[model samples]
Target: SLRINKGMHVDGNWPALGAAAAVAHSLGLTPAQTAQAVQIAACQLPMSLYLPVRSGDTSRNTYLGHSAQLGQSAALAVASGITSPGNAVREYAHVVLSKEPEPFDDTHGFHLLQAYVKPYAAVRHVHYGAWAACMLRPALDPDKIEHVILDVYEEAVIYCGNRAPQTPLQAQFSLSFGLAAMLGWGRLDPWVYREPQFQDAMLRALEAKVQVQVDASWTQQQMRGARLRIECSDGSRYEQEITAVPGDAQMPFTERELVDKFLGYCEASMPLDSARLWARQLLVAPTNTHPFPFWNLPQEKTPC
Candidate 1:
């Protein structure tokens, strides 16, 4: 019952929501009930609305969190004889895709596939900047990196280039900060999101090197494109251009890599063995199981 589009990145809590909905549907829950469960699941998800977006914040990020909880809630409501819009997902999809008028097509091919995932847990726009920063690392010593020129799609600058980041959370949304971390550390990882890293002198100097330029030809269809150029004090120059960031379906992570990432994020919170066991089960389980003991673990111990 757990149906997923091929080549999609099931990041954040999306996999959990999909599994819960499939299990509910398989247990004879009506479509309306299933829809209610999904809504409830989405409502319970944690929200991160502070991430900036072009012109204004789009509800895409917040909606996904809500959609997960909503799915669960819809499923439970149906099981308990509650009623909801029979075409819940259809309607919701219409809203997100900017469909006009009532009676939207359920088969209209909503382009959820266009959504991208973050390989580095930072703002989506910052991914290319991070990629660029990492590429320049070997050529330029952190102390010698004099400046960075970030040539990105116009939308990226507007959304991710706000005032200087004053908090770790804010830094995640800053192109300059992300690039600085990449230049100074030779990579961007969860550890780079810490307070000390955010306040480092070398990072600030690298941040000063960051600059943005708008690419007029870019379009929504070309969301993943970015270009970076770096200059070092010893007359060394490094540059890289990526049409699409890594972790997209075109450049998917290997199964082992994905599993490693999942486990790495969960091990500290959950029993490492249990998390590994459940992740294996999820990959090949014939049918979705009941709330396995694995699913009932304490919230702090749950695998992301």
Candidate 2:
């Protein structure tokens, strides 16, 4: 009755339902119709696995993109009078997949407030170690570092245990490489997942030094934590243990920080002034008439 234990890809499994509900609501469907769309989406969802991720093949990346398409398709299907079983979600979960999906009462409020926005590009499991590595980076000399050890919760090891991962997506799921990226680049920016960083002498060297181990007690308690210990060639050791990463529900990023992150990304593709205007229009003004001001941003001219 445990889908995670059965190796379901949690990433793709959940987004489809959320997307379906979102689209259905945006289409001005009634509550009952939105429920129908979500139910239909759930019934058609795949029992995805981690094969592509494990093998460094990018095929699995399509699953989430397909999930978005599936969501829109399901909403459209409902609009076109496609009816789903009354208990399609529960039946498919308990009977077909032997899954016991968590029940949410939603009594108090929306769960969107509790959502986490990642400061780094890696999985949530990899963030703790990556953050710790970033902290120790300023103190350590990369060339003098002899080895690094990461003791993390059990599931972190299971889902993010890739050693010397060969591909960008594979590295995204790698605990060792994420930590190494932080140490080498002083931050685990999305760009570090590229082939050149993977081929970097310092990153490759540091990545090879990283050893991942399971902290059995933490796993038994189902705790999310990471402890990083770096052993230097000169016998100087640096260590840090983190119980929570930034941007988590308990330690959410401030509004200013979040806005800064948005500005940073937008500025990368456009002028700083344009990025500021876009942010102010979209986020500050709340103008419905000029929705998505990003479209009006400057575009480079095509070569004739």
Candidate 3:
């Protein structure tokens, strides 16, 4: 998604910081040193605006490579005691932003999330792109569909429509591909980007028929909306307009949902019981408790 939709390389920040901190911890750096290391790494961070999507190969590893390396480099630099945190961040910022020329795009996935998708995600259990996919599905007939037309605000068109998406990351950033994927598979799942599914003949046909246009009337900043119009081969027409998405400050994810997501991440590696135990300890543990019992949780033994 960072490849095309949003030019800002924010996805790299957390991983780089995490790597820096972990290295600092291993080196037994003082709090000040650790902070300085993180600062230095952040300053040295580079954004990869030029996506290799046009060249194919959209693996997660490829997208995260630069950020991950920079993060570890920061940690290593701090461990070596040669980097001055304050000056490093300042100088790096000047060098990256001022000394170099970079292309800037006005629309980004972050803005779409903050302004539109999150609200819908919070309310409908789907992001705006996914919601558009779902809403467009019923209008299309698997056997007789002619084309799909999506009319949305300018930023939506700018951020979501990618004509040449070669990788899953590019696919996710594409409004047309995402919607087509949802329609082709009846729903979008992480696995939808894998194997035969990525090369699914039916989805490619559907995606080829998607066209997105900007609605000139939605010129205001707060106008976050989209209209999906379908034209069938039988000369029939269907339209759906979404003026508001859910999950804004007005609508929120329930506490149970948050807990479910947290547990899902934990259970991906360990047993559910272990995840639950750790979660209980992490949530209820008193502030500044030493030894951090949650971190001491036993590793899962591999089944031979």
Candidate 4:
């Protein structure tokens, strides 16, 4: 099967379609125009390969940024009177699957309700093992750790099986590496994916101890979860199971966490007060009826 892991890299492919749809909506395009925009995006969708991700190539990181830019351009092109063949999507769909296009069963309901916001820089599949390891961090000493076992759903293991990854992208996609990194650093934020962390002797030792297994129960339930067990040389064992990571609706981030996350990103470019003000304004922008704010960053050479 040409699935996400086998032949396709989903992150490289899906963003264009999403960006097209979102831009079309924001521009208030009619259904037909929106369809045209999507068709244009579909026709130009970049082909994806999983091999680069497996080898930790830097090109893999550029896929999403390029996809998003392509998407935005596709939507704007449509708004500027560009036209795309109406059947581009179904044609490629049939070609890709080598089967007739089947209707989507909308009975599964709206996709927005199923969305998960990410708290860490790693892939979603890596989160379960990482989260479980973090839960056990307080109890175990990194130096004395003898072996670690990560039992997770089959798909997670299949898609993200890298061990002792040496690069940022590889670490992001590696369940075993994520577990060790989280245990060593006590967190799985972007900073943990740096070169210093990659070269850390303790983290490397922890990665060597990890053994991943497939848990049939989680696979059958289609659940994103992991059971992590660590054995230390001191004749001690620690184990924990994480059924979900934060950002899942059932385990969502608190309001404070959300605000902090937003500010964290914003503060990199603007001052704290400006970021806070931008956060407030952006959070309430959807409810506000004023003309769409393009960009309201203060240009004044003084603090607000």
| Candidate 4 Cα outliers beyond 4 Å, as residue runs | 1-5, 72-90, 99-110, 263-281, 284-294, 297-304
Off by over 4 Å in 1: 1-117, 220-222, 270-275, 285-304
| Predictions: Cα RMSD each | 7.9, 5.1, 8.1, 5.2
lDDT ranking of the models: 2, 4, 1, 3
Candidate 1 residues 1-304, lDDT tens each? 1211222222333444564467577667766555566655443333333333322344434555555554555565657676544444444334433453345336756457655456786877888878876765776778877767888886667557754677665676678888788878866667776667768877887787788777766744555567888778899888988776677767776778778777767755789898888788777766766336856555784221
lDDT by residue for model 3 (119-163), tens: 211112224545665766766675677878877777665545566
lDDT of each: 0.64, 0.82, 0.61, 0.80
Task: List residue ranges in candidate 3 displaced over 4 A.
Answer: 1-35, 47-49, 58-69, 72-94, 98-126, 136-144, 152-161, 164-167, 214-225, 233-236, 241-251, 254-304
**Clashes per model (N, Cα, C within 3 A):** 26, 0, 4, 0
lDDT of 4 by residue, 163-282 (tens): 778778888889988888889888777667766767788888888889999999888987878999888899998999989888998998877787887777665567998778767766
Best candidate according to lDDT: 2
RMSD of 4: 5.2
* TM-score result, candidate 1: 0.64
Report clash pairs, candidate 4. Answer: none
- List where candidate 2 sits over 4 angstroms from the true fold: 1-7, 263-268, 289-304
Residue-level error in angstroms, candidate 2, position 54: 2.5
Give lDDT for model 1: 0.64
C-alpha lDDT of residue 226 in model 2? 90
What's the true lDDT of residue 220 in model 1? Answer: 48
